[model samples]
Target: MKELHKTSFWESLMIQKRVIGALLMREIITRYGRNNIGFLWLFVEPLLMTLLMVLMWKFFRADQVSDLNIVAFAVTGYPMMMMWRNASGRAIGSISANISLLYHRNVRVLDTIFARMLLEIAGATIAQIVLMGVLIAIRWIEMPADVFYMLLAWLLMAVFAVGLGLVICAVSVKFEFFGKLWGTLSFVMMPISGTFFFVHSLPQQVQEYALKIPMVHGTEMFRAGYFGSSAVTYENPWYLILCNLVLLLFGLAMVSKFSKGVEPQ
Candidate 1:
């Protein structure tokens, strides 16, 4: 007969942390390698995308110019959008890529998915910070109006991203085709994700419907924090919190149920 091992909750948590840390390093090395640019590409990829979008908007917007800071608008909107976008998208095939690691009992299905999500979120976050710093240094964008509020929005969005990623990762295990389609589908989500236009600027009727999307609240909250009195925003933090909790519960259950069918290969 095989013996079973028991661990206290704290012990189990510590062990999970160690396992996730190892997997994170492995992901960085395997995906990015140690060559030039290497892991830096994590942030650089999103940073460049955000920069290009900013430049394009700055140089060639077809609309009349407004007093709003375009650089800050893009910086706040795009990176926050990318965090959730890439988190769930990248989580789709994390299981297959790290299937071999499952042979080690300490590693888990959740750990692999989490490591990828963490990497994606980290890249978006770092790129945001770096880009904002540079822009502020150059006087292209003013400092954030309420750093704490912006940070709260960022944190809530991260939670939302992880919850969304878990659900998607679990679903992908059941539907291989979904894994293939998510990459393109996520891009389609960007425009409507509130990354470009402010909800306040939208028609009142359209704004109400737009607010129904969870990501919209996150972006609106973040923009409100950035623009302060200058921006009129409709953000319900508690509503977003409720949505996060629901996604997390549903996602964790889905992941656990689907993972049981996966074998160490």
Candidate 2:
């Protein structure tokens, strides 16, 4: 009989790191293949979509807004929203896509889910950075006022996205209806997500309702950082942090509950 030896926590962590790294590479290759620019599409795709939105806003809302910088507004808001959107959206298929890999001892359902969400988050982050740099170089948008605030908001948003993805993944795994309806449901969530509107713009009565949304805090926090004293923003970092914690805890519990029951099939 062979006796089992347990690895130290550090050792176990390293092993999981290696496993996740391999999964990330596998995902990139599987999604993009070895064709032209392959993984580069990760960022390029978001950049293009964001560019299109920026152009559309420039074309349509030219005279509609005299106070705000429409170009900067679109540039900052859309990509951040897309990060969470893509992260949560891609999480649905992760378990099924890598179902075969689950037979391995090192691979986990959470690992597969994390890998996919991390990829989307990385792509959106890179696209946001690159687009901002280019736009600033061309004088299309000014540099952010508070870089620390901007960075913090991005970090919070990323975590929020992962939490949401975990919950969405768990729900989709448990119920077929959620998996099928997530696409439509996500669209309905977009407008209210603080993507296009500001907390200040909404009426006093509705502002409280808007603040109830964690996504709004993230968006508002990000814009506050970029727009600085020029714009009036109501962002409570503590509230967003609280929401993230609750969501993350609930999501982890749900995923763990469902994953144990998920055999190879």
Candidate 3:
């Protein structure tokens, strides 16, 4: 009877949700106090980033990519990748960075990690919506071809970001240089992830490699919903979703293991 009672899934969900919510609120306050712009920058930062990337691409790659819309390409691709990048990068050293808070017994390590993830997700989501809205208003990017699929892709990408964030956070707690390593890697990943150009426009061999990067698939899927038949072939939303799930489970397991002795030791 006790075992059966402990197996109540809904009860567990409620508990986790309550914990996550509390942490999220605290995170918001700590990260974004009473500034006038406050949470608005979350959206604005990404918008500016996408715009800059589009401008740079137009100046340099105007010839290689002439068919599809570059602004739409940047808006779709950069926001998705930026979400994961920002989440994971911020999460990487969060444990050690927030060690003062962790000293409080009520502050679980998972709570700290979760708080960071929520903060990043909130910022990323705001950015995405704001950019999409502006693009639609100006007729720069169209509404999604398949809104449902686009939403599904966003959900999976968020989950994937959390998973990767957890792993990076756990690792960074033990190794200082892992943080620097990620910075370099992120710089290298920008062009390869199809942030400015359409992957389907690549040669067949290059296309295969681009598809291997899950962000490419996520971006292409998102743009497909926006551009309909004009969008590139994402072709493997299921694959990206599966990869996210696997990464999430693996990350959680690793965090649990490494998190045991992370408190001020």
Q: Against the true structure, whose lDDT is highest? A: 2
* Candidate 3 displacement at residue 110 in angstroms: 1.9
Estimate the TM-score of every prediction. 0.94, 0.95, 0.86
lDDT of 3 by residue, 151-240 (tens): 877888888888888888777766778878987887688787666667767888888888888877777777777778875475588888
Pairs clashing in candidate 2? none
User: Which scores better on TM-score, 1 or 2?
Assistant: 2
lDDT string for model 2 (209-240, tens) is 99999999999999999999999999999999
Q: Candidate 2: minimum summed lDDT over ten consecutive residues — where?
A: 1-10
The residue pairs in collision within model 3 are 144-225, 145-225
**Cand. 1 TM to true fold:** 0.94
**Candidate achieving the largest TM-score:** 2
